[model samples]
Target: MVILGIETSCDETSAAVIADGRVTANLIYTQQMHATYGGVIPELSSRAHLLKIAPLVRTSLSKAGIELKDVHVVAATAGPGLIGSLIVGYTFAQGLALSLGKPFIPVNHIEGHIYSGFLMNPAPEFPALILVVSGGHTLLLNVRSHTSYQILGTTADDAAGEAFDKVAKLMNLGYPGGPAIQKSAEKAVRKNISFPIADVKGDYNFSYSGLKTSVLRYIQKNFPDGVIAPEEQSEIAYGFQESAVGALIAKTELALRQGSYRSISVAGGVAANGRLRDRLADLSAKYQVPLVVPAFEFCTDNGAMIAARAKALIESGIPDYGIQEPFPSFKSVFADAPLVKRS
Candidate 1:
């Protein structure tokens, strides 16, 4: 089967071709313009997708050594993302499918992340615990089977990635804080400086908003003169990263103990963080459970994950081809969840 996947959930315009369950070509165009704005401007993101989607698709198909007419299915992310950005890719996929007389599958963006573990070698064991830490979502899921998932917990406030961005901005680091913070923390000396982790009652749910605020207040008190040295910034970044990842590790351990999962998988953009990866590795070794994480390429918003998910839906015999438009609402997108079985 030849599936063409399109993704523009946030700031990336991506296209990929999957041939017979293998990702043949994946092309992504990231919006560097957002760096100047310190955050994604929805309008700018949508416009950039509109310009990049077509060329990206063409390039992907070419790279995959296939023509558009050869594609059997067209899939696009139908959201839990910016509505404008979602529409650009969704509509483009719809048009392409219509023109080629192919099946159009509207994929939930979050589901793509959930299933991304399947894209790499060493597949996560069934009944795995999945932690999706991304810019827009931080969720823990109990995945009992390939198509059965229970949402274990979710963020009540800002996601971990969002907290990273906000903290980086406060430090004048850069937009897309994960990489910036990780790089800065490499030179950090204050490994013992601590920040409070969110303490949610009676569930595995996450809360990073308070943690973000605490960092802000900490910086204010510590850097009262408003002139932060490079080393000072690095130290602060290290402290923040440690706190953020510590919370995730704590909750994951809780979930692991509760579920007795055979394996644990991490996905979403923040999964690419070096500090988080190292921590998760330690946990995996300590607990003697396998860990599954995508390669750096699949960790972020991308078309390959979408393509892998689309292939899963087709093989599962549960794809909803009736989806005609982008459904960007987060809650409603659950109805279109890819790795969860429908009643």
Candidate 2:
């Protein structure tokens, strides 16, 4: 099957073509202008998607050595993201699908992330344990199959990526804080020191808001003048990163110890984190399970994962009746829609 997938979930406008479950071409254009304001501006993000999505799709098709008429299906992210951004891609893909008289699949954005690891070489084993961490979400899942999963835990407050961004802003580091903080943290003098990730009442759910606040208070007490040297920045950055990544690993270990998963996977943008990858690798090794993480290109929002998921849904017997409106429904996953725990 030939499928064209479009993604405009946040600041990126992406398109990809998949032929028989293999990625032929995937293109992404991120809105770098958001850095000027220290974060994403929704209106501007949507506008940028409108400008780049079409051209990106055209380029993706060209790169794949195919034309629109050759595509058998069209897929696009349907939700759990900025409504404006989701609408842009959803409408575009639907329109194209209608014009070509092809089937349209509305893919869940998080579901796209969940299965991203399946696209990796030596694909993750079935009934895997996946950590889906992104800018807007943090979730631990028991993925039993391509079409089934149980949401084990979710974020009680700010997401891990959100904490990174907020802390970076506190340090005047930069926007898109995950990379910024990671870069600064790498130069830390005291590698062992770090802020603490507060223990939540739930066995597996996460809480990062307290960690963010603790970082803020520490900065205020240590650097009262609101100025920090490069070295000091590194110390704080490393400590914070340690705590954030440690918290994720801690919960994952708890779940792995209790479950019978054969593979441990990390998906979403934060899965690109060096510390998280290393820690998860060690944990997976300890548990004697293969560690599965998607290639860096698929770490963040993209189109190929959506197409890959559409293929999975089709193979799993989910029919694409037609294109529908987008909804920010984080609860409804792939075929066997399930509700995740928040508290």
Candidate 3:
């Protein structure tokens, strides 16, 4: 099957083509406009998607050496994202499906990330421990299969990426803090100033709000003038990243101990972090299980992941095509969606 996938859930305008379970082409256009504003402005994001989605789809299909008519399935991220952005991609994909009389699959954005491991040469096995952390979400799941999951833990407050961005803003590091912090931390000569890892007390649950505040308080207490030295900035960035990733690792370690998982996979944008990747690799090594992390391209929001997930849904005896409206609420989107048979 040739599937065309569209993702406009956040700041990215992506389109991808997959033929018979293998990725043929993937294209992602990240909005640089958001950097000036220090974060994504949802309105701006949707408008940008409207302009880029069609061209991206055409380019992706062209790169895949296929025409629109060759596509058998039309897939798009349907929800758990910016409502307007979701509508742009969802409606556009539906339009394409209608024109071709092809099946249209509305993919859950997070589910797309969880199953992104399938994009690798050897996909993750069932009963894998999956960690998905991004700007809007942080979740640890014991994936029994593509259709069933036992939610191991979730953040009580700020999501991992959100915390990174917020803390970066506080330090004038940059917007979308992950890369900025990494760059700054790289310059540090010493990484001693440590931030506290939160104890959520709910077994494997996570909490980063406390850690975020600690950074602010540290700045207030030490740099009372609100001006940090160059050396101090790097050290602070290094310390914050260490603690942020440390909290995630701590929770993941707890979850790992509870299951007989054959593999461990980390996804979403934060999966792109070098520190977290190294730490998780160590944890996987300790457990003697393979660690699966999406390639940087797939780590961020992308249509390839969505298409792969839609294909899985179709293979699982699911009537994969449908008209699903964009869900704006995070709580309900996550709850009512994914069709997760929680164990």
Candidate 4:
């Protein structure tokens, strides 16, 4: 079946076409407007989605050499994103599904990230642990089956990606901080400035708000004049990245041990961080568990993951929706009972 997926959950406006679990075309238009602001403005993001969604879907279909009429299913991210952006994609998917008389599947943005693993690493084993670290979310999930997932832990405050952006902004790094910071860290030598990791005992939960504040304090202490030299800035960036990655790895190790999961998968926007991916891979080897990390394109917000999830739901016999309310929060999106029966 040919599935067309629409994703506007965040700043990216993306679409993709997939057939039989293989992606035929994936097109994404990232909003550069957010760069100047140092963060996303919801209203602007919504407007951007409005302007970009149609062309993106058309481009994806054209690139894939498939017409809308040829699509067997329409899928879109319904929630866990900006309400306006979610509305744009969800309403579009609803209309397309109605016009084409095809199933319309509502995919959770977080779930889409988790399923992204399958797109890159086929034949993933069940009962694996997945860490989804992104701008808006930091969650650890235990995947018992294709459709059965249990939340192991999540961030109580800032997410890992948010920390990256915030720290990068503080250091005058470019917007979309992950890549910029990663690049800067590669050239600098870190002084091993130790940052405190949250001590949430017996729980896989993460908290980055304190870590962010600690980084700020360290900057103030070292750069008393509130201005750092170029070299100092690079070193600070390196140290910050190291500390953040260390904390994430620690939590992941704890999660694996607590859940006794033999397979580990990492996804979401922050998973694109070279340092984080490298550290996680090293730790996976040490723990003797298989590690799955998606390619950079799939790691960020995209439509292919949504399409994959939609196809799974349709094949599993979940009822199709003619329409769905746009969900602005994660809680609202996954609050409903599982769409498919657990094995």
Candidate 5:
């Protein structure tokens, strides 16, 4: 069965076609309209999604060499994102499903990230641990099966990716700070400047706001005259990235020790960070366990991940909702839906 997935949960307007568990075509149009503002403007993002959704879906189907009518089911992100943006995709999916008499599946944004590992790895064993770090979310989940999930840890304040963007803005770097800061840090020399890593005493909870403030204070104390020189800026970026990745790796290592799981998976936009991936790979080696990190394209928000996850849900016997409901903060496994095995 071919599932058409739509994702307009944020600044990116994307769509994709997936047959079974493989992505056939994926198309994403990132709205750069927020670059000038240094952050996303909800109204503008929603408008842009409205303008791009239909054409993007058509393009995705065409790229897959299939027509919309061939899609047996429809899937779209239902919530935990901008209300307006979620509405755009949800409404479109609902309309299409009703018109075609196909099932409409609701996918959680975070769950989509977790399932991203499946798309890249394809055969990950059950009872795996997943870390999801993105601009708005940082969470660690324990997956027992295709439909069972337990959240082990999550950020209490600012997400790791958000900190990256904020630090980039402070450094006069362009928008979407992860890639830019990574590039700058690559050319930087490791400095002795120290940044605090939030070591909250717990099993797996995380706090990044303190680390972000520490960066601000470090900048103020070291570069009191304002605006750092190019060399100094690179050092600061390098230092900051190290601290953030250190905290993440430390927590993940601890989680692995506490949980019975042996496999680790990392997802979300920040998962695209080369340094973080390397650190996780090292950790995986140290623990003598397999680690799954999706391809760079799957790390960011995209329709392919959504489509791939939806296919899994359907094959696993999760029923579809005929009407779409915008779940702004829904949290549950795909098994929450009634199962219906197809012959």
Candidate 6:
């Protein structure tokens, strides 16, 4: 089977071609302009997608050595993202599928993240505990199977990646904070310093708003002159990174202790953090279980994951909906459609 996938969920415009179960080609274009604003501008993001999506799709197909006529399935992210951005890809896929008389499958953006780990070797064990930490969402899930998921916890306030961006901005660092903070944190010589980690009374839910505010306050107190030396930035970045990763580890450990999950998997852009990977590796060792994380290429928003998931759905007997519309948010993932469409 040949499946073409489109992803315009946020700042990236991506397309991929999956032949059989393998990703033959994946092309992505990210908007670097967002860095100037320290965050994404929805309108601009959508506009950029409109410009790049078509060429990206063509490139993906070409890279895969296939023609549009050979594609049997067309899939696109339909929700839990900027509406304008979502519409661009979703509608494009819909039109293409309709033109080719191919099946059109609308995929949930978060669900795409969930399947990202499947792109790895030594696939994750069933009944896995998944941590999906991204720019807009932070969720812990109990995945019983490829098609079954139960959200164990979610963010009550800001997401982990969002906190990283906001904190980086606070430090006058550029946008797309995760990479900036991680780079600075690596240069830190100071060790054993601590930052606040949210406790979040009951359950495994996460809350990063407090942690973000704590970082802000700490900066105001320690760097009152508004001029932080490079070393000072490193220390603060390391401290905050430690706290954030610690909180995530704490909740994941708690979930593992309470459940019979056989392995742990993480996806989304934040999963690309080297520190988080190291900590999770430690946790996996402690529990004597596998830790499934996708390759760095799949960590961020991309179309290959979507195409991979479409293949899974098809194998699982999921049928495509001929035409569909995109939804803006994926807040009701559990209550959404069975296999296609978000709402």
TM-score for every candidate vs. truth? 0.96, 0.95, 0.97, 0.95, 0.94, 0.96
Instruction: Encode model 1's per-residue lDDT on 264-324: one tens digit a residue.
Output: 8999999999989999998899888999989998999999989888888888786774445
Candidate 2 CA-lDDT value: 0.88
**What does candidate 3's lDDT look like per residue over 194-290, in tens digits?**
9998898858888999999999999999999989987899999999999999998998888878778988999999999999999999999998888
Q: What is the lDDT of residue 29 in candidate 5?
A: 93
Model 6 CA deviation exceeding 4 Å by range: 320-323, 338-343
Task: Please list all clashing residue pairs in model 6, or write none if there are none.
Answer: 80-330
How well does candidate 5 match the true structure in TM-score terms? Answer: 0.94
Cα RMSD, each candidate: 1.7, 2.5, 1.5, 1.9, 3.2, 2.0
Clashes of 6: 1
lDDT of each: 0.88, 0.88, 0.89, 0.85, 0.83, 0.89
Scored by Cα lDDT, where does model 6 land?
0.89
lDDT of 4 by residue, 1-343 (tens): 9999999998999999998778999999999999999999999998999999998999999999998899998999988888888999999988989999987888888888988888874545788888899999998888887668888788888998999999998887878989988888887865655678776777888888988898899888887787877777778778888888887888888877666776889999999999998998898888898998898889989999999878767766664532257788877755553454322
lDDT of 1 at 14: 94
Off by over 4 Å in 2: 321-323, 332-343
* After superposition, candidate 1 runs with Cα above 4 Å error: 321-324, 335-343
> Model 4 scores what on Cα lDDT?
0.85
Residue pairs in clash, model 3: none
Give candidate 3 regions above 4 Å deviation: 321-323, 334-340
For all candidates, the clash counts are 0, 0, 0, 0, 0, 1
lDDT of 5: 0.83
